[model samples]
Target: MHGPAESGWLLAALCAGTGAYCLLRMRSGVEEQRRTAGGEALMGFGMAAMAVPAAVFAPPAWAWGGYAALFGAVALRALWAARTGAHHLHHLVGALAMVYMAVVMAGTPAGGHAHGTGIPLLTDGLLLYFAGYVLLAGARLVPVPAVAGASGAKGWGDRPELARACRLSMGIAMVAMLLTM
Candidate 1:
């Protein structure tokens, strides 16, 4: 099993890289891409804040509350925006997940508790959900055979596909975090 410290660094690197990629896509001059980039960047930074080594930056009790509040607000915004697009619904789910993690982590003791591999209902269910999502999203991101005369050409930071990859990356990172908790 990997230690929290090691996993923390790994998650940080993964999220940061993913965020940078989203920002790169934002440069495409597409309005939708720019909006998605903003959300992706926020998720990346939020994950980094949650996943960084405790030795380097352990958030105080109040900080966890702050995180919960922030994410809760984001969740509401996403929910409101969901009326227009399915992507917003995904954002709503992501925000709620963050809020859930923040609340659970806040309740945990300072040194943390030992988590068994056995199913614990809620946590384990969430783990399974995220795991399945990551796998499916990753599969979609893979290059597939295109039909003749079809537009298989995708520029940097394309919507839907790139957004899916970013969401998948965040979901994997979130699973890594929940495992350590």
Candidate 2:
């Protein structure tokens, strides 16, 4: 098995790159309703960065701190969104996964826990959560008709490209997570 330290670095890199991409997409979806989705993506990206590094590489002092901050921020935003607007169960669960990851990372030792049992179970949980999130995000894309006289093509969802990006990035992250696990 590849060492945890190596995995941590890989996860961190994946999170950073994916998160940046999500941020870019968020910029394109500037509407308030759409912006929330972008924020959800950002939460995943940030949590992935914090959690994956701790899971794969040498756990560092600041790792949990970052994770905690990401978790708290997302959790609060999710709650606020839920209270005042359309709340998605998938988003809530995804946010919960981030919180769970933070807790797991905080409890794990620096070099990581014993393999085959404790660590594997936790990793499995993370993998499952990420995989589910990918599915949820992908499912958000639904077919929509084009305007009869509109110049551009009609399709499902406001931005198929952005939805595709979210799915691709999350899918890759899920794969990376499973492999690392």
Candidate 3:
């Protein structure tokens, strides 16, 4: 999103598509998958909205406040969910990161530089987090005996590989978003 218009559009599409897939994945037979997919879908959609090209329609500073508030609640929800599983902790971090990014964007001037306005160390930490997550999630995409792919009558929504790929895509998108910030 920090790059060209083309890149912003691509990122938006990727995030939105992943979000939609995750939404459908909520119907999975596994209750845990359903819960995880629900949170992930929210995150994916939120990222897509944020990743929209500013050149097209820049939100007012106040709108960024709304974003912060929204993600704040999301972060809280993710925190509660983390009690059930360690994976939800990642969602909590992601929601908090969104809130941080929104606050940063609110402070940026109308005509901003390529390198966004924020504490370099903080931004770098976020970049590192997302990058490492991408690597780990990408590795999980490779199917193994323990991490078997969906078989028989399982729907696309229930496929572990596709779910992992969705998370991987979101991770890559997060890295890109953080880079621009």
Scored by TM-score, the top model is: 3
Which structure among the candidates has the greatest lDDT?
3
lDDT of 3 at 88: 84
Candidate 3 local lDDT, residue 55: 81
Model 2 agreement with the true structure over 42-137: per-residue lDDT tens digits: 765664555454334455657666776776777777777776565444456556656555565566567664233225665777677667667765
For model 3, the local distance difference test gives 0.86
Question: Can you give the TM-score per candidate against the true fold?
Answer: 0.83, 0.62, 0.91
Query: What do the candidate models score in CA lDDT, each in turn?
Result: 0.77, 0.58, 0.86
Give candidates' CA RMSD values in order: 3.2, 5.0, 2.2
What residue pairs are clashing in model 1? Answer: none
Q: Tell how far residue 117 is off in model 2, in angstroms.
A: 7.5
Runs of candidate 3 exceeding 4 Å displacement: 145-151
Runs of candidate 1 exceeding 4 Å displacement? 1-3, 114-119, 146-155, 159-162
lDDT order, best first, reads: 3, 1, 2
Q: Report the C-alpha lDDT of model 3 over 1-181, residue by residue, as the tens digit.
A: 3457788899999999999999999989888889889888988998998888888767776988898999999999999988888988899889999999888888877546336587899899989999999999988887676536635677866888899999999999998898887
CA shift of 118, model 2, Å: 6.6
